[model samples]
Target chain A: MAELTYREALRRALDEELERDDRVFLMGEEIGRFEGSYKVTAGLWAKYGPKRVRETPISEEGFVGAGIGAAMLGLRPVVEIMTINFILVAQDMVVNHAAKIRYMFGGKVGVPMVIRTPGGAGAQLTAQHSQSLEVWFAHVPGLKVVAPSNPADAYGLLKSAIRDDDPVLFVENLVLYNVTGSVPEPEEDFTLPLGRAHVAREGTDLTIVAHSYTVRRALAVADRLAQSGFEAEVVDLRTLRPLDVDTVVESVRKTNRVLIAEEGWATYGVGAELAARIGRACFDDLDAPPERVAGAEVPMPYAKPLELAALALEDKVEAAARSLLAECGLVGSA
Target chain B: MARAVDEVHDVLQDGEQALRLLRLMLLIRRFEERAEEQYTRARIGGYLHLAIGEEAANVGSIDCLGPDDYLFTSYRDHAAALAVGSSPAAVMAELFGKVTGVARGYGGSMHLLDVDRRFLGGWGIVGGHLPIAVGAALALDYRDVAGAVLCQFGDGATNIGAFHEALNLAAVWSLPIVFQVINNLYGMGTSVEQSSAEPELYKRACAYRMHGERVDGNDLLAVREAAGRLLTRAREESRPALLETTTYRFRGHSVADAGKAYRTAEELASWRERDPIARYAGLLREHDLLDDGQLESMRKEVADEVSEAIREAAAAPAPDLGGLYENVYGDERWREQFERMDTAAPFGERMETRSWQS
Candidate 1:
């Protein structure tokens, strides 16, 4: 087994893929000499040279669209946006061209490109930088959206995202870079399938479904509940687009109670979609109505406490889980 | 590289090439005329943008492109497609949204494409495709591919942010591409003078320190000359350039636009006087390259071909409805992934409905 930080996992995936395939290259602002805004692409730029580790100007629409065009011409381009919030500038290209090219062209060509971007609010980066827009890309049909919570999944899913034939939005968490976990050994042939959910902690009392950073919060809440003789199941939804509803329904069937945690607004969010599907599939099995724990519905403020309250934190996940368990009449005895 | 003025003289001396340019321009004119008629007859739906008066700008620049070059354009693309050798019948069939059309009728008038020919697409967004076109040029540079890209758009696209970004990147990267602006006087209804602070669009290329020039788009031989030279420079030296072809649309922006609201009849008549087709014909006659009989025969041949295109397009069948789910995803695994979302009952209710059974 090999241990790696979330940021290291992402870097390893990029390094391995660039070495494995010559067609794979990178394009983004400050990604080469600047070593990325997040420093995830630190040494790879020095190793790959200018052609492979291509640097771009602060023109999101220009560079993102260029990536799509290169992909159409049979090259695998991994485009990195500084953050998901800045991706709005290139939304027209991402939504209209990258996602719709293959379908609009009647399947004549596919845009095999990966857009690696990070989202989530915790770093007091103000309203503009602090935002979660995974649902925006996941809402689209042609793009595949994947957000891995752990270091291992981050490494495996990114490798798969680069190899995927269609355009993939590889969403990452801004705060999970320092977190570490054991990845498979380099000698072991390991690659996680997209659209699959992982059961991080198995329990019988309740099911807490989440994705990205929220999964880590939910797992911690599960561990806390276990101390009080309450068993809580945590399902980390690794992929959002080709959502694994079957695995979620199976978890809901066993637990008979459901709670969804998301870092975005509650209305029309990824949690909303998951709750809708779980409500429909496990209606007869659910001991109580599906519940959600999400961030405050306003634009993230700059204040430290306000930002903390506005973000999806561990305390929020615990309260939501406890309330759902109480409603299902399975209150744990401390 | 061939100088712009020298190529004009060369085109004049070569009677065979001059006649071919005249024939293609006539074919595009005839095709657009028939396409407008079909739109009125309800054979074609969606927006129908015509390039009736801008024949030289469309035909001349595209004439310089070789089999190795890639071409991209804005929505007013029927003329460019025809100039690039897509059959008139297939183009018309696409407008009809028939199964046999290019893009399989999926992309109608605004989104025509022929990937095999390297005419990437006719993008619908105003300035949306410029950066994408730049990226294609970057790919060519990266692979050291011996080719260049021609990105054609209307004057309206110049005001957009993507346009500026694309030019800046193309200059910085030294991508092998030419950004051809077909200044048709009006971006839909707003004139260039009213819209741009510096209405001389070619001069804007100087901001990126790239080569830029303006040619009288109505002059067929001149447009062909400048475009050929610039394209050669791009492929040989990997230098990006901007070529502005100042032309005009004879009709309104689309078929629905009357085109009379903003401009007077006198202005319309003035542009018509400089009709690219008639002007080219006059020049060809002056050079003893074309006679009245030959011009008449050319017109008759174009009219016949356009008529046959309409007939074939109208007869072609529509794409099957069962394939509604097709082309959405390239990977075969998507089928199994989407299968779980499928339920015979509405609202995800798997229970069998007894009302129909009863």
Candidate 2:
């Protein structure tokens, strides 16, 4: 096993998939010669040449739609949208065309394409550049949405997404790119399955549910709570669309209390959906109502302190966990 | 199997292939006339956009496509579907929303697709499918596949951002695709001139550094020749181009409209006088390729076929409600995994068969 940065792991997945399948090609703005805006696709252009690692203009709608069309014709086109903010321009293509093509055509063809974009808010990159929009894609039925919490999942999930027969929205977080985690050796062909969640930490006192970057914050928050004698479990929801509710419900039953944490807005967000589902699935097992810790309702501000305050950081998650425990009388008084 | 209808006979000195093309056009015209009647009788529901007077543009352009090449069109797709050799009965059943329809009742009048025939789709969204067509071209190029894409759209689609994006990408990538703008004068009620700054839509290709041309869409032979040339160049050289087929729509945007507010009777009459079928039949008569008897027999055959399609479509059964949620995702495993999330409240139950086999 070797520790690799999330960015390196992603690049390795792309390199391996490109080498493994001639049909798998990259298409996006700044993905080839520009080495990607986040440098996640660094050196791919030199390695695979322009055809496999194709560079596109700032035309998200055009290129994204093209990726769907290419996929329909039996090419696996992994398209990068620079960031989730730019994905809006191509929303019609993704939802209307790619997602609906399979069903509307009565299963004649499938869009075996992947739309990879990063959506998180740690950097002080104003309102537009920094916003978590994975929930938007998750709300869409035809799309498979996955957000990996670490490098290993990042590598495995991306490879699986490329090989998937249906359209997938691979959501990446800008802030999680440099985080390090141990990945399996190249000789060991590793791929995580979609529509499944993993329990990152095992505990019985409380279940802290999260996905993507929030999983890291939840683990850290769990560690802080453990210091004060609260053994909180963490459930990493790897796939958001075909959500692994069974896993979340299992953790809730074990803990009898839950706190949902997310890096997006709480209202009508991933947390809202999870909370409602948990309320039904873990109705009798719950010691208290499921609580949620999420990013501030306002659009992300540019100021560093304001940005940090707006984020769903470890402190906010810890606070939400502490309140859930207090409400259940598992710790101190509310 | 034949690349173009013209190539079927190097010495159509006899005009057998020409007569076949005429028969196909006649079938579409009669099919559309019956479809209008069906709509009036409340057999077909939803928005019905017909390609009534655009038969020459539809049939002529499609006659140029090789079997391997792909075709995509906008919602005015009954003629396009017929020209592409889709089952007339199946297409009519689709308009009737029956289970035996081309799309199995999933896609009504607008979203027709036949993957077996390489007709990619009958997209309801105008200009949205342009980039998709370019992507198909990209796929063919990547795989070294021996085929190209033919994307047909209306005049108003030329003014959209996707039109520019799709053409520009096709040019930059050197993808093999021939974009056909069947400029039937108006998109819904907006005329091409009032809607597009560059009403001469083929010239819009100059912005992308691609070849562009316009043809008299009412001239069947002219349309076929121009389309065949552009498509051949696309397949052989990976050169994308724009072919503007200037025609007119005899009906309104949809079946609901009377098609009179924006157009005058005089304009309509003048265009009708230059009817493509009549014009082609006149040419055939002049060359002694077809006689009055042959023409009358062909019309009678097409009318009979149209009547049979309507009869079959009306008799076709409705789609099975048990399979309502099929194909929402390509994988059935997704349904099994997500079934737990289906709430039990009113209107919250997922529309999936508990056991489709039973």
Candidate 1 deviant stretches above 4 angstroms: B1-9, B337-358
Candidate with best DockQ: 2
**Predicted chain A of candidate 2: TM-score:** 0.98
Q: What is the lDDT of residue A79 in candidate 2?
A: 98
Cα RMSD to the true fold for all candidates: 2.6, 2.3
lDDT tens per residue, model 1, B177-274: 99999999899999999999989999999999999999999999888888998888898899999999999999999999999999899999999999
How well does candidate 1 score on lDDT at residue A227? 90
Indicate the residue-level lDDT of A278 in model 1.
78
Cα misplacement distance, residue A134 of candidate 1 (Å): 0.6
Chain A vs. true chain A, TM-score per model, equals: 0.98, 0.98
- Write model 2 residue lDDT over B51-115, tens digit each, in one string: 87899999888888886699999988888889889989999999999989988889999988888
